[model samples]
Target: MATPRIDLTAAAMLLGLAAVWGGSFVFAEIALRELGPMTITLHRVGWAAPLLFVLVRLKRLALPRGWRIWGSYLVMGALNNAIPFTLIFWGQTALEGGLASILNATTAVFGAVVAGLLLRDEPLLPRKLIGAALGVLGVAVVVGADALGTLSLRNLAQLAVLAAALSYALASVWARVRLGDQPPLVNAFGMIAGSTVLMIPAALWSDGLPDLGLAPVTWAALAGLSLLSTVLAYLLYFAILRRAGAANLTLVTLLIPPFAIFLGWLVLGEALPASAWIGFAVIALGLLVTDGRAARALAARYFLHTVTKE
Candidate 1:
């Protein structure tokens, strides 16, 4: 059998996924202007849930067999979607849009570290450690050194954003262990379901039905977030996960910062400071190192020779 080469379809899907997630921050900001964090989060979860359910049913995607998988999916949904979604919205409510994005970029570093600790087979390598450390340093730079000492509620809110990333990292590792074998659509559907159930009470108590008096722009942003960012982006993500594995798919976080920064500039007229650009570059480099593509090539060469000799 021949070794499989990466197809263009997968590449395009991944790119689209990255772009959607990157641009999500901008939409989140727009939505936040008129809606509370809980309200916006509910829109994302509630709308996407039914839409994804319809899509899953149309595709006839069956979930994995047994309660263990369903139970795990419920937990994964909370960690990956409900909690982080709410946290980022709340964090962004107090923080600058660009600053919140910079904080969200920490997801990859947290994912790598968490995966190493929680996963038995995926041990931490020296290179990955160095890469993750560099990525953290870049995040600090991107957020601007001046913002660190604000000593106000916003600072704490930014920390909450970081905490959300940490939770997502844990969720990623947990998903691999518990739900990796299930079809991508099934897993995605389960997550949307779980998030909907979890967010209902919070949305009702906090927002009490989205203030229908909001401007059309706010409604448009909410729609974009639910349909494009939450539903479509996740579909592409799950597709990539099925083809590429979670470890590889997760590396897209490295690409998200630059894309998010660019979108912020384009959509929101936000200016990127020099430090943020530098931080973006460093984070990208760190992700490349952690992915271990070069190591894989070298290993392939060594293994090929041994096999030939045998």
Candidate 2:
């Protein structure tokens, strides 16, 4: 069977997914002004879950009733949502949202490695190892070798972002293994619901019950974080996954950092160091390498497609 290529619509959705996911960092940053990291994390899944539940219901997808399935969703929730979201949100407390997104770009590289080790179908390719090394190098460049010397909050925050990437990678493997048979919308709802249940107590215990009174801007950020970044993003995510295959979806990982950096710069007046841009480029290169594509060929094909369409 031939591999499916992403057409215009899938590409657009893929871009949209990256934009919203990238904006997640900005939203978290905005909320962090008044909210604790745990509370922001909780707000994300807590608000998104019910929305997804409504979506699942409107779609009329049968919710899996098995505890075993819910058990998997719970694990998925921890790996995918609760842990990663909290880590990334907390990371943003110290790290620039742009840099966090750049470091988060390593998710695809780590995902390739983790998936290779865990899943039989995805064996360790030489390119992947090189790509993984490049990814590590990129991170080192971004965080600086000084981070290795001390356990400072900034260093820890950088580490936290990388940890979130690994969590996301594991979540993909778990979803493929455990929730592959469930409807995509159902799995989305299930995992978000599971994570919300887990996060409520975690947030309350860590941050106390959240204060409802907030600035209008913070509330807007929370709404955007919950609705656009989580709910709408997932819908776009699964739709693109179904249409373009999992491999093509990895392209979104590369697309996220730019939007994040742009939003950070344009809205928050944040500026990144040249090293950060260099690191992002390196990480992007690593991802393309891991995809086993010659950059030249990929560009050529894209240009050819554009010309043909024109």
Candidate 3:
């Protein structure tokens, strides 16, 4: 099958989605001041799930029914939302949001590896291997050689965020194979619903009930995280996935780091080290290589024209 081309509209939506997702790191940081990681993760999905169901109803879309579909939703929720959200929120407690976002960008690298293993259509290509290697090297650079030598909690937290990224990669592969035919909104709703179901009990067990006397800013941050990042971002995500192929959608990962860093700096006065910036560039290069756009462009510019002229 031919890949879908990303038109200008889809490109715009992709960028918008990247910005929303990137901003989530900043919001998570703000909300973490008052709420526990479990509470934040629970509220994120709990609030977004009902709103998404409302979207499903208003659009008159059929809700995916049956135990099998709900079972898939439960798995997706665990992979995509519950695990990642909790880990990321907990990691952000120790790491800066910008750094967390850079680590999160590794999702594509992991996704490439996961897809190559799981999907018959996406075999492990040479370029992908190189890209994945570069990405891992970039991560090492970001974490610094010294920190890696020690078993510090900070290092553990960073690893947790990367683990979350891997979970997202696995979830993406699962969705492609199992739930590709479902409507994007329906999938979004179902996954969030499943996340809510899983998170509520976990939050109660871990954090107990959330404090009702929390400050307004924390509440606002929670709302922003749930409404803007979780709900609206997924809608845009599925829309872009429909119009553009997954390769094009992966470009959003490249766009996220800058936005995240900038928002963290602007909002929280957080600054990244020079090494983190260098590592981020390397990761971006890996993403470009993995996406095949750099090679394609070179071919179009140099090889294709020469061959066609002959």
lDDT of 2 by residue, 278-303 (tens): 99999998998999867658889999
Q: Best by TM-score, which number?
A: 3
**lDDT for every model?**
0.80, 0.92, 0.91
Please write out the lDDT profile of model 1 over residues 129-219, one tens digit for every residue: 9778887887777766777777677777878888898989898888888887877777888987887788888888988865788899998
The candidate scoring highest on lDDT is: 2
Q: How displaced is residue 204 in candidate 2, in Å?
A: 0.8
The superposed Cα distance between candidate 1 and the true structure at residue 59, in angstroms, equals 1.7
Per-residue error for 241 in candidate 1, Å, reads 3.6
Root-mean-square deviation of every model: 3.9, 4.0, 1.8
lDDT value for model 2 = 0.92
TM-score: the better of candidates 1 and 2: 2
In model 3, where is the ten-residue run with the lowest total lDDT?
241-250
* Cand. 1 Cα-lDDT: 0.80
Where is model 2 more than 4 Å wrong at Cα? 1-3, 295-310
